[model samples]
Target: LPDVRSQDGFRASLDAIIIMRSNLYTVGRLIEAVMNDNEEEAMDCVKQGADCNQVNKHGAGAIHYVFTDLYLHPPLDLLSKMVANGADVNLRDYEGDTALNLAIKKTSLRPDNTMYKVVDQLMQWGADPTQKDLDGNDALALAENRKYLDIVKLLKKQKTSLIVPPPHETPVPSPRYQKSTTPYESRSPITHSPSPVHPDWGTPVLPAIRSSDPLIAPDREESITSAIEDDNTDELDALLNDPHANLNVPNSMGLFPLHVAILRNNPVSRNDMVQQLLNKGADINVKAIPNEDHDEGGNTPLHMSAARDQLDTVRILLTYDPAISPTNNEGLTPYNYAEQNGNSEMMRLLKEEQRNAERSNKSSTCVIL
Candidate 1:
């Protein structure tokens, strides 16, 4: 080796080595977080430049650990984050099991809907159910061997050839479709209509919203909706910063962007999305007029959050100055919905937030904008 101390390239060389070492350390931290099942730390490591696909001696990647059942329910949210960070879903461990395979295998430890959700998410994320493991059992075969009919049904329903189109294959949809990976998305074809128009579901959720301009185009709107559903803050920020994006008004569903953020059932990202929307000028007290959805009509985001038993969402909403226990068109407040649903946790959260709101109101000057 040459004496590089006197060379012009020495500083660059040292910086490169330091960067490499930092990356390796972050990767190690990611592994440690995975072993401990600390998704927050894992995400921290990912954000700090840890490679999501970095493997251990056993060849298990971060994706594998997210669904591995060493103990407790798997950190499936971490799996989504890992995939979004470019972790390959089909990558195998030493035992030749993909993340989906391991998730399906976990049904032996605890046969529940959690595993099903993981499996379903992995599939939507482009996991090949046909990929087999060492024992020659593919995802479907493993589900069948385990006698988990729901998984079997899910696998059977997914067409092997049609999950995602190849790059060379040109799609034939008229207006082009923007498919969403979230479970709430319907696998429906795109319609050739004006932006944000619903053919089957005629009219806006609220009559007043019918006059509210969509402002954003269909694909842009869908992308934003998908971002909200996934709690993808980076994507959401980009979308919200778009000149055409509108956060305050109701969509065709008679729901504002804030309402969608409130109703998402993800364990993570609920509060994060809410905070992002609020930062982007989302109205905290905007009422959702979900037409004919029973008493869901005239519900503020708080009422919707309480009625849906979204305790964390309610907690986040309360942090912003909002009307406490604001009644809907049904003459029931958020607390009433929580009580009606028998959600004790939600009720407690609403009660505490109401007290906090009261205290806040007593101290702060009420300035109408």
Candidate 2:
């Protein structure tokens, strides 16, 4: 080691290690590296002083991006590296899901050790399975439901569980949390099912809606529509496990569960409810067919949310990639709804998302070509 080095020389050497970029601390690169599953690049970023726990706008870090559905296994090798470098195992994302919750949700009974291994490794790394998701489902329930017996046994071994935080502690996902579902389809939803009971429209969910029941805790026997409108996240969460629960099925008044949920207004439960509905395959862009209530008819969930000036709800919906310009039967788009309410923020948000959608399309087109 050379002695008597100049202060300026020592400072320059430190800057060189970080690649002296315009942003200086380009931690965003670390997020990108993990998102693409590039272990080599991820390590390089860490070596150059990237914060392994650096979160995106959604409060999700490298660990949060490592999960996929049953068809793909989480990149545990990369996850291990991030955790070793001080990444948080329990950081909640926009969906209020910790890494453990995502792992269980994403895993299935594959031929061999393709997926279950991720769950084991996460548990070993101090992932607390007791941490409940937005809808109050924990890792144990998720694994048990899927019949991943190995994972269930592993969770059962841990005798301790966490008490869910109060509503004040519930994490709210910012607008940047990615919702990536394909926009509205022109086809109708799955209707005419008799086994699942329809909601009671007479018990209005919205303040100005047609029902009389006060928003309360979800009941053991609540219909999907009533559960949604009442912001009964617990009931809605339990119902999602039922293979027969169909959110797309419209009620007698032509209102789908998603339509009711947008107006539910229970801030604590509303976002989680919307997320649950979407995750269980609710159609993001389905329109309400014209009915006796023509004003309620011809509006998409987006239109309803906009008309109600529900900014947080709109942000959550926008993440799922709703069609910004889809016209209702009355030929009004979501933008028109925002405009009529004079919600300048919603209008601005809609415009920005429109630009983002256009850019995303171009990127997809480029990749396809």
Candidate 3:
């Protein structure tokens, strides 16, 4: 039948294969043991040829698991051991996130201030700061966005300075407006109105004839205006709906219904009232009724919204007409108002919208051409 020498050789070969498979299993168990925090067993397994750089199905190397999980805490001596034994420090996870980035994200909000240490360690170990996430945000940009001022400051200091050397001599542009040859002069002396005898009723007013032939006289002891004023939404609604209540009625200060609402400090109620009025077809672009005491500023709701930095209100008003610009008493537009208010976010949004509009105009022109 079979040759006796051939049978002996085949039996030896099978034994050798079994021993190799057993060694692989022992190596795998050692890695698992290390991950389980059994240091002695892990060392023995490592001695038996457990590859420290070996990754699981998810591409998470031994160091990745150590850094990302509770296998070992920082000071990272075990991590250093794995690294020294040939672990890939810069190995990426399934989402392409590096070990350092994941470490930072994990410890960013840690209560013990360990995040800074982790970040420092990463940086020292040559972690890339310029690497971008899926949203195109770099680490520095993300830190700034989340208001991590300290981290941002540190990162900025560590990075190469962006400052440029000033030119030796820069040319200045000539003034567009010509200077007046003659010295400026005051126009005229201002005259003051005669002082009133009584403070409450400053001046006597004549009864004016209405369209119904009724004379409207100033009433004595005008009701004290409360800061909360009145929530008289029902009355306002009725007046707004009424064909005869004169939607153009002005208060003593000559503030229109819309103007009064804008000037009020209570944003919540004022916004509600504004929305209600707008729902009843109130003119958002209505100019304030002019008064002798104060110029009504000719400010539309959009102008007021920008001045107050009410971004939501500004957005709503812009939806009606982004191009609408109500001039203030100083002849300043809403854009000017936004700049004066120091609303950088609002200013940026407005500028971006303006740029988009310009691009759209250019595209349309190209089509026409």
lDDT of each: 0.70, 0.67, 0.55
Positional deviation of residue 88's Cα in model 1 after best superposition, in angstroms: 1.1
> Candidate 3, 326: how far from true, in Å?
3.7
* Candidate 3 lDDT score at position 304: 67
Q: Judged by lDDT relative to the true structure, which candidate is superior, 1 or 3?
A: 1
Error of 2 at 248 (Å): 1.0
TM-score of each: 0.45, 0.39, 0.36
For model 3, the stretches where C-alpha displacement exceeds 4 angstroms are 1-206, 209-229, 243-252, 289-292, 355-369
lDDT of predicted model 1: 0.70
lDDT of 3 by residue, 1-369 (tens): 889899899999999999878766765775577568776676666666667666667666555555556532543665556556665666666555665556555642333335555666666665667766566666687665654433453455457423333677553322211122333211111222333355578753322223231111112101111121475566565555655433333444444566556544445766776676566555777765544434445766666667555666666655654454457676867777677645677787777777777887898888542
> Lowest summed-lDDT stretch of 10 residues in model 1?
203-212
Q: Write the per-residue lDDT of candidate 1 for residues 271-318, one digit (tens) a residue.
A: 778888898788899887644222356888887776555666777888
Between which residue pairs do clashes occur in model 2?
Answer: 203-211, 204-211
